[model samples]
Target: MNAQAVRNYSNEFLNIGVDAAALGMSRSVVATTNDVNAVYWNPAGLVNIEDYQGSIMYASYFAGIANYNYAAFAMPIDKQSALGVSLIRFGVDDILNTTELIDSQGNIDFNRVSLFSAADYALTVSYAKNLIFKDLYFGVNAKVVRRTIGKFANSWGFGFDAGIQYERDDWKFGLMVRDITTTFNIWNIDEDAFATIQGAIPGQNQELPETTEITKPKVQFGMARKFDIGRTFHLLTEVDLNLRFARTNDIISTGLGSIDPAIGFQLDYENFVFLRAGVGNFQKTTEFDGSKSLSVQPNFGVGFTYKGIQVDYALTNIGSIGNALFSNIFSVKIDYSFFRR
Candidate 1:
């Protein structure tokens, strides 16, 4: 499997949430700099900013996937305690639908005409504090989701995220687990939909047709180190391991064990701007072909923070195609934060 082939999504909801148009395309992962999304990318990063700051992020991705939006606020509750809140939203525009069905005349008749869309949002609250030797941050997220199609409800589910971050003199380490105890039950599921599925003969009541939400285990563990190579210049290196466990009907994509590792290096100049370029095995480093190849192997990014504003951009490959995944393969991200006493 190509490094880029390493993929995981807890809920099917993510299928519609992952967009190519969004920034951070370099790795098909969320972009984090100075925004509330840091709460998701890595809650420990939330403490890197000022004591009291508020931020917002907006990412438009996948020509039609969605508009990913995030907002957050962090405050110092006391000398050793800090609290924060963040929100994330993803969804699509309305869609037109017209399914063909046989009418009473044994001819095709499409009577149901409707428009619908699917979207999901999650809210998180985080906290960080210093331990006996260094900084230790613990955070949790609560999410409520709803999915619908036309006049019928598709499914709805709830999930949570917990993470811990630790920092020392020259390194930073963090761990996170997401999507714990999640389920989906759609609204108004017509019994006819399951009349025949998976080669099962029609049955009068094997069980109520309920929404089946996708569930998976996701974990992220990583370390980042800083080095002083020259005067007024710094080098930052980061390596992370991600594992995903999930059961899916999609055979090729289903399984419970897959390991993904990512590494990146950035050169900082004058404590203001950074020139970054690194290659990581996103999914798999090689492919089924007989030769070694990099699928989504290159990550090039540039970021700078001046005053109260910060912006970053990165480029990657959705695949080796010159179409939408090529030219639009680049992602640009902008974040704004306000500091208050």
Candidate 2:
């Protein structure tokens, strides 16, 4: 059974910035988010922020083997405009970097080790405005990304995102272009630089070659429906289709890949209690036994709201990635409306 999981984008850290509710809903939230979290998912959703809002979230995998943290704030610019800022950090600490040792006999030694940390981070500034036409909204994101592999190498990149949303009654439609500008990561350590650095290390004898990675644009299409069962009960159903663009060896040749879809549902009672469920991160593989299988991760979350504060918790199954351990995600958000509509 050869099973390999592929992350849609080379920037895997993008997967770590979702809100608790979105994570619980299998990430089918492009059209459902309405708060500061929208800064990461779909900036167009920021138009739903009434006055001002702020949120912070943290998620740990396998008892802190890895950590993901996110924070965001959004405020209205005017009756039809909103702006937001967000930050995301994901990383593993205390990683041991091992280098082969050589004895007098030129025998290999395995005791030499170095400790370092690896991290991926991003900062985003977003803006959204309701168009003059009906309920149409448009938004954009300007972001900077940094990735580091210990001290050996680091990369910096800049990207832009844009999104549009249309709402009518209880239905919402959304489309987002993630990394619309085709982000490029420039590494600090190239082959020539690595050759000089590696030569100075007593135990190192090989040079490292680094290549720039280009993250192509991705498109997300989403639709959601809100059902008001009664004065105290409500349900939300949503779906999102994600398509990624990839470039061939020529770099200039790009095309769309397979479409991945996600679905989720949320139930709420009196705006005080909320329940959410979702399944995503899908992949198809043929095991060593030559059996075809489809794999997807499932997550569940619950939330409480009182006054202007909301707390959300999600139990996410990490599948084999976490040795079958369940990961926990927690988030808190506060919203205030200077003038109630």
Candidate 3:
């Protein structure tokens, strides 16, 4: 926590980002057959669903001003081609901004509230395609991000991710590289920077503050697989191996010299209902004290489909503070059959 801690108004959920159902019960939906939630988790899973399907989820968790919300829509292009789009918003509220200055008596004073609340948002476009043999599939996604920090300034950037999934039969395999070309620049950035925001000093020369920009990292490589138990039940599992070249030396970062690994799983019932769960770092030492390094207690979730719409929900234990409820993920998906002669 010491090395990877954000000091400003950053939306952590957008990065550690999870679908409403996944975030609940500790986020263990990786290996399950919930391709609907995979858009936010893995884009390759898009081709697994029916044609012209879309999903939306709204969460009321984290208690205070923090929020997590997202939506995803995916459709098959012919038989081997598929496309999708998603939007995610994470942020906090009620922030107090003030300026420091010197009074006539040489005492320190502060300016009034400069701004109100701040947030971060990501707009993403993703596409996927299946190979001729029916065992290999590929996917890619592009994202535009916006971030605001108090009186400092706002920054914007563009990023890209690519992935591939291979499955011979009932056993399915998945793999992806996240943030392959993630690039961020401080909006209206300059060397003099925030120095102009300075005020008069007691008796010394004029002083100006210095501000800097930080760049997001490009995490690489994640692997997953799903097993079918005959026809009624199924099991899904995955492991992510992330390595960032510019992680510690990035512009906007904590400068930590380390790698993060995560593992998770899911269970499906009748292909229409799902019970999912997972465990990983980042938030592990958090909820479950003395839990497994990767276990972090347990993550569980369930989802069902009726008509053409699907709804997935999870259960998390709060223990005392009335239980910190996360969010729910919902979507309308379609799966079509196209067999060649």
Per-residue lDDT for 1-341 in model 1, tens only? 11111224535433221212222323223212223445556555555555556555555556546566666677656665556776666667676544324443657555644456666666567665555655776656666665554443465666676667776778777776666444333345545543322113434455544445445557767777779977889977777665667443221234555556666677778767766765544432344565543344565667676775555655543333224342222222233333331
Best by TM-score: 2
Could you tell me the TM-score of candidate 2? 0.85
What is the full ranking by TM-score, best candidate first? Answer: 2, 1, 3
CA lDDT, every model vs. true structure: 0.52, 0.80, 0.55
Q: Which residue runs of candidate 3 sit more than 4 Å off their true CA positions?
A: 1-13, 24-36, 98-115, 189-231, 242-259, 282-297, 315-341
Q: What is the TM-score of each candidate against the true structure?
A: 0.69, 0.85, 0.68
For residues 1-341, write the lDDT of model 3, one tens digit per residue: 01222222232345555554565435433333236556666677677766566666655455545665677777777677778888887666676544444444757566633454566778888877777767677778887777665545566756677777776554555555556654443353332424434432234444332233334454434556667888788876766544444333122233453354556666778767777776543332233454433223345577776565556675443211224444333333433222211
As for model 2, its CA RMSD to the true structure in angstroms is 5.9
Residue 323 lDDT, candidate 3, scale 0-100: 46
Instruction: Tell me the spans in candidate 1 whose CA falls farther than 4 Å from its real position.
Output: 1-8, 12-35, 100-113, 180-214, 246-256, 284-294, 317-341
- Considering summed lDDT, which 10 consecutive residues are worst modelled in model 3? 1-10
Best by lDDT: 2
Of candidate 2, the 10-residue stretch with the lowest lDDT total is: 245-254
